[model samples]
Target: MAEKKIDKARRNFLFGAVRRFKNEDPDQIEASTAECVDLIKQANALYVDGDFEAARDAYRDCLKSDQNDADIRYRLGVCQYRVGKYRQAKLEFERTLRIDRTYQDAFLYLGLTLVRLGKPEKAPALWSQYFNIKAVVVQRELNLQIGLLENGESDPADTIAEAVEKAIEQAGSAVG
Candidate 1:
């Protein structure tokens, strides 16, 4: 009888939590949106002013309000990366990617973090993803470097044109 009662209570609690989450008020979302926008602006201003520490704090506050925001998470990761918190930066970037799989910048930065960690082999997929999203010339240059590192090739720029051609083909496939 005791075990049955305990099981019933657990089920009830779980149901209640799910109900609350499912019925979360629209007003909460609106309020959080306003707060997040303001916080993002402040954080950006701080970053532009070279106040990275303050920017980090502002980004953290934004995350507290809307933990699921991929852009905010990505900005926070960049700030953390600039501050030399590589592991925390990686975690934030990973979380951003989890929220939005198509976030190219997070993948690029995550690849950078992996490179810093001496895991060069793990960077090609992320670099490829970034390339597929945007055709920035700088990113193209970086991709060749990462590809060279992964393949243990000493000449990074040897096949630059060929790699860019392939990357463009891949990017076309992505849009299709």
Candidate 2:
């Protein structure tokens, strides 16, 4: 009889919780999402305008609402970097990459942050990965240009080979 009473109470509590959840206003949820989007947009504008401190604050506000947003974390890191908070920026960037490993920009910034933190030796491997991805993108663009040229399109001022060579030079300079 005690077991039956406990089970009944447990089921009643769950049903009550579900009923309360289902009773939430859809408009409230939509408003919350829209507010988050607006905050992110405002933060991005502030960052672009070079107001790093303000942008960082706005990003923090957004993060309060959505802790798992990797892009927000990355932008916050960038703001921290601009403000000379290298150690904090490093942590944020690392967190961003942890949340989204395919975030190439975070990797590049994290490496740059390491360099600024006086750990230059650790940056090369990160930069190498960044440059490899860059090279692949450049190669794709070069192939498109070559294809256009082969089909009798006007030759661009700089050939695909020249672009590839320049990318290699820049990569070398970045590493060395």
Candidate 3:
């Protein structure tokens, strides 16, 4: 009897909360969302003013609600890079790319981060990848032959096809 009473109370409390939310005005919700936009504007202003630490903190606060925002993530990475926190910057850049692979600026910043970490040799590939994204963007209008792999699907290698098939067969592979 006590457990049943507790469950009823919990259900009533949740329903009351939902009803209160449903009664709130849509404009109120939009204004709340816009607070994050305002924060982003403030962060950009701070960054432009060379106050990277403040900008970084503001960006992080915005990210708490919109964790998947690539632009904000990229800006945070730039702030970290400016503050000489190469590792954190690298992580932010990597996360930005993981969220949106077409983000070219992340590639550029990631390369710079690598160079700062004393891995100059690895930076070229990052730069090339950045250019590849640019090439793809520009190629559509310019009609230029900028070789960019737009998709993961590719024609099977002719030379290794049979050998690879045989090896797979030997290993009892079920790959189609």
Give the best candidate by lDDT.
1
List, residue by residue over 35-92, the lDDT tens digit for candidate 1: 3565678787887676878999998997776677787788788788778787998999
Score every model by TM-score: 0.67, 0.58, 0.57
What TM value does model 2 have?
A: 0.58
Model 3 per-residue lDDT at 35: 42
Candidate 1's C-alpha runs over 4 A off are 1-31, 132-135, 154-176
Clashes of 2: 0
State the lDDT of candidate 2 residue by residue for 42-142, as single tens digits: 88889878799999999999888666678889989989987989899999999998898877767666766775676545654665555344455543443
lDDT over C-alpha atoms for residue 128 of model 3: 64
| C-alpha lDDT score of every prediction, in listed order | 0.67, 0.65, 0.62
Candidate 3 local lDDT, 81-141, one digit each (tens): 8898989999999999999998876876686677567654555566566543223332231
Model 1 Cα displacement at 107 (Å)? 0.9
